[model samples]
Target: MSIVSLSSGEPTCTTEDVKAIAGANGFTITPGSVDETAFLLFANAFDATCEAIENLPEYEDPRLKPVIVDGERQCHRPDAVENPLNAWAHKTTLTIPSAKGPLAGRTIAVKDNVSVAGLPLGLGCSPGLLKDGKHPISPIDAIVVQRILAAGGTIKGTATCENLSMFAVSYTSHSGVVHNAWQPGYATGGSSSGCAALVSIGDVEEARQSGKDTRDYPLGEGVDLAVGGDQGGSIRLPAAYSGIYGLKPTHGLIPYTGIAALNPLIDHTGPMTRTVEDAALMLGVMAGYDGIDPRMTPESPMPDKVPDYARDLQAWIAGKEKAGEWTADGAAKGLRIGILKEAFDVIGLDPAVADVVKAAAERFRSLGADVNEISIPLHKHGAAIWTIAARPMMPHFVAGNPPDLLSHTMPHLQPNKIGQDYFDTLAHRNPAAVNILMNAAHLQLKYGPALARKAHMHVWELRDAYDKALEECDVLLTPCNNTVAPKHPASTAKTEDNPDGCSERIMDLFEPAIGNTLNTCSFNVTGHPAMSMPVGWGKVKEGDGRLPIGMQVVAKRWDEASILKVAKSWEVGGRWTDSR
Candidate 1:
């Protein structure tokens, strides 16, 4: 092939831009004008590079069958907040009309991080930070979104997510601090804040017609289900605090395509619902391989194969009833449950919280299951190793452009500018993001990539340890958080001197995360399916009245069905939840 100079339809590189960019990669450029020979050399390299880039495989869209057309922006409100519970990120109301399916007539709210084609995706970041506006209407729908719409569900709106989906507390959302549905002053336990709140209360207009504010600490009787993504316990945390059932399904079961991924390896999307059955029903629709997501494979569970995971729960309930083994006091015979001592004994766990969770565990024993303490010493170190590994590596994926559009990891990671507006607002609105970014930067600079690489090795060991422990028991139990719905640092009235209680001394980012991360984050990194179900209520020293306490149940890989059965069994038995 001829080394053609100034080839037709080739990418043109400006001299100054080329020099600046090439300098970063250790290339030196002289200020003098280049001769024809040098220009030809540049052209030769450019043409070859273009050929290589063009030759790379393009993403193949799953092209799912639909009532709604693909790539159509069906709902949105640009440059404005939609409503209070929906958050400031973007306001939208959409229902991609579909014929009757399993989830027919069900209303759902999806987290902002998940894409709905033609709807603005704020990703819980400020409008100005994104190039076009606060809510950038997504060009394509995420796999879960398509699945839900196809299953005859109604999408209420795009719910608010924490800024960059980084914080556990709802107050850090880009639109604004989200109000706790249970108590006005308490944290909603985010980044799935809007979904939890809105799903529980029902539609804003309809709830008002029913003479309820919808935001007035209503239970999830109105809306059917909500969807949430978990990179580091986002789904489980919000559901726990909001007193609903939330599951972080085993990673790779649901295609993550079209979601704004914080970490490819850790991301999972699942159902948050008022009832365990609704959660299982939603899971039956959402779980499966979509060809688009690079992470999904043939072995992952498919909804069709396990048709009616929702209905199967009743069969188990019926069997227990037939045996006369099921009583109003207890249900589910011959089940074995293990309570993790490490999660209980973790740093600074509230005694009251521990008591409530323990009572729930003991109920399983009353229900005829052998309940015992299973020790996995490595679990104690999960959070620490997660910090060393997951925390430090997240900024690379979130702040920088990923190598692929679908969820993927950048092997040769390099830090990129996260944009100025993000930091400027995040400093005050989400100090947690500031802390995380700064911590990641510090760790990377201090130990280099070798430290993160070594930390991944520890993560694998932790997963193996958890798997071995599961062999002895069907499920592992833990308190979801040390405190149930702690008063929001920004909004709660604690001292009486300050009604809002958002004073500078009290505005601590790590406080909300203190007890929450110890138990939940371990499952996130290990790709294990874990759930947080509202089991009992307890009063906190920091607040008045009894608050909801969630018990986490983690099952072995692809064993979500087992855990769901257990959760439903305990729920129907009526001893554990009613004891509060």
Candidate 2:
């Protein structure tokens, strides 16, 4: 392409403008003929460069074109009756582009932040916070969405996420609170709340169809699988609480090109499914280098080279069976399992929940695996290091100006200039969003960049610590959440008597999620592959019935196969609910 010609208009800079610009940066321009003339010339060149850039055509990747039909774009905001759990952001069905791939006949839900052409990308924020009270309609498909269509998966709709995907609980989504699939009015851990609920509910329906007793499950319809984003436990937390499988794949294993990102360092998108086999099938199609996102590295397999995980898993089981090694009493004979000692010691951990996870971990011994407790002292500090290193860069991301790191940037999805209106709307729905903005700014002002730099260095150390631990064991096990899903708190909407929109204090809205991601977030920072597997059942703190308890399975970086194998062995042994 030929370069666009620069504008011939007169320079817009003035000596006064130059002085004002320099003054803002704690500097002054000398007011003399020679200095003034030189400064004006320099400023004009900069302006010309910017104008020339604007004149160039916007770049769009030819590989990621959307395939929307004329009438396929029609979508509606489902009513409460249509969406009992309030998990859907919009409901529509897109055409399946293929019919012979591995995911043939499967239904999939995409998270709200992922771009699906011609659909409203709500990002789970209130309409008032969006431009003109409307969410942006995506113009192109995300890389994952493209892969799903090619694999014969029908696009069901966009699933709701937490506000700005900042909270770990489901009640913060602007669509309305998402109730647990197992029990209404209780929490479904988020910000991948909708994906979790949909897949879990789908499992219940499937169980009923197979003549399995589902008298305890609520009535609902859901998709077979879902694509979920994870920054810090968003995907896994919900999976644990809802009795499903959610994987946070090793960083860059799946391209994040068309998804809304919080920070490039920790952003990941993976499968949320009701079965380990389904998770493997979805990952097989999704894992590969797209040549667009900077997050993918040399470690990422090319599209054609991606392993058929579902096939490989079955082959592994078959081989074990042929050798008479996959017996009922020794399904995991060759596996080495480690219980992360510090994961059970986090503050606010429920005694019953801990006991449930402990019992689940010990069950591995019955399968002939070597199960033992392993200690990684630095594990306890991983969350703090992750917070400091990543928080300083988040405000820039929230404002839609992420660092220009040569990735496929999504400028159209960036929000309008943030102001009081944005803050007020976000604070009422989810104070966590506002808190991130303020905390990032405060850290920047007080510590400058040194603190973040130091914390980032510690991130490497933390990774090394976990690496050392994994050297002694194939997989490390930890309780996914400190407790079973809690009851949903009241909304923060402003009321006549409570003008501030808070129950008693501003912190009340966030209190329920304290330390929720203690075990999961560390693996996110370390870039280790982790999966939340439903292990048993634990009682809710405030309720009488039981909720699913999940145990996190962590493997070395890019070793999702190990996670799948370990989870599958336990899965084949029997029902997790029976273990309780």
Candidate 3:
């Protein structure tokens, strides 16, 4: 099967264009080719994308290719638009007031789960027929979104969020999967998938040949910034899979004012970008207090007008350069990084991914900060507390009484069509599905103090253990997934039987007891800032090409600045420079 060329902006790619770009970029996108080496090299050169194809190499192996439809030599490709709305509207801008003078040139993508008045707040679900004729309006902007706009950052549009922001992959109850722009064939890791996708895809090419504004840069300006919410691994997963920098900041570090709630104790809104410094500038703008969010911590609001985090980041880079820790060109000389050996191995990850992550760890060690192998025992129970606390609330939010769903209506009421349809299918399969779901709702009625007690105990233990581990290191590193981007399933639609399977796989990868909660959930639960940065490319079975690998860096709570400093150091080290 051949790919359609996207170089012409005829709304989709054409076979001939795909072939031409593939050849020029040193790879092939044909089905059944298993072109791993070519794919990795191609992915490495994505930033310099051909007249129209930057980053296509990120997922360029044979495994990355989708199975050919009908096994025929087709000349034309599908012209379907993945998330066509009533109208695309003009891609506009929203300015955020910032203490850093002004974020004049920066651009950002806000997750639909984070409310910005007027735009549909579909958290990817259908609200059903509304009794009230009035549409939902966000009384105020979600603190994070407001902060970004205030900083002079221009808003593109709301990026799609997963079903009620429940799942890890980004498809919502409204939009289906947001394909990874880095590697067209793999999953973009959800809930925050759209933000990562738009940022990675950057802007449309002027024409295919000039190659001046390669597909990698967003609108040909400053770094692309993305703001998203994570109750589980939403932000981290997509950022990692997309080979970008994504941070799940300490819980409550930023106000959640208009954002939807998943697990209040764990829910957090954060930033994603191609670089850590960009992430920092976003955080600096968005972090602070607003009385509207009862969850906001009283930390003096960190100054309503904070200086440009970019300047601080630049200074840090300069210091590293002067100290010979890193070259001015972005290669680190010496840095200390620790591998969560136990955490990385528990997921039954692909050997190639494991190898690449290990190689990255070794590279940091060679550059000279202390390197250590360590384990966080409490990580074992992470998934349990997560499910016990999170699952019971599913029915309530997914299909409970009207108010419960409406409470989080703005920005993310129902984000994905697949997710909503999935729920509808479950309801149709067994008329009792709705009743069963309602019974499982997260109301304290059933979960009360008894369940809360159990959850609290486990959480306390885990938090205590996490704090101890952080005391021993500046940051902890681990793989984003057990394998590279999992093959994008033939479709995101889920039958009742398959509903929990995908979510389960993600949970288990991050934590067994809690299942699929490995690398990300722990951070969300612990309320610490964790950043997922793409490091290298690797192969996976069924992934004909190389998939990007993400290194998860976790820091102590509210110490986002430190995490950014370290991540910037890594970024300047040339790890992602070649990630293209």
Query: Candidate 2, residues 1-580: lDDT per residue as tens digits?
Result: 2122332478887899899989988898788678888777777777788888888977778777896432457788888778888888888887665456888789899999999988899998876666666788888899999888888788889999998889998877776778888888888889999999999987666656776545663445689999999999999999999999999999999999889889988999999998999999999999999998998899989989888899999999998899887866788989999999999999889999899889888878988899989999998998898888888877788878866688777756757678898776776668888988888888878998899999989999999999998999999999999899988776444458845344455566788999998898878778999999999888877757778999999999988999999999886578785565
TM-score of each: 0.84, 0.93, 0.70
Arrange candidates by TM-score, descending.
Answer: 2, 1, 3
lDDT of 3 by residue, 1-580 (tens): 1232212333233345556667876777864355544453444344233644443433222211222212221111112252331111113345533334355567776776666554555554334412132224333456666556556666666665554555555433343455655455456777676776666654223222356334342222213778877877778877777777888878877777667665466778878877666777777777776655555566525555444567787887788777776753334444446678667656566677777777776666545567788788777667667656555554543432323311223322332232454455433222222333454544455655478567767877888887887777777887766666665554344557655323333322222112234667867666877888788877645745555678788877777766777666655446553543
lDDT by candidate, in order shown: 0.72, 0.86, 0.58
Looking at candidate 1, what is the lDDT of residue 114?
Answer: 76
Off by over 4 Å in 2: 1-7, 14-20, 30-37, 68-71, 131-133, 206-219, 492-504
Winner by TM-score: 2
Best by lDDT: 2
Tell me the number of clashing residue pairs for each predicted model. Answer: 3, 0, 70
How well does candidate 1 match the true structure in TM-score terms? 0.84
- On the 0 to 100 scale, the lDDT of residue 510 in model 1 is 59
lDDT of 1 by residue, 70-139 (tens): 3344564433223534342444445545447888788787888877766677777766655544455555
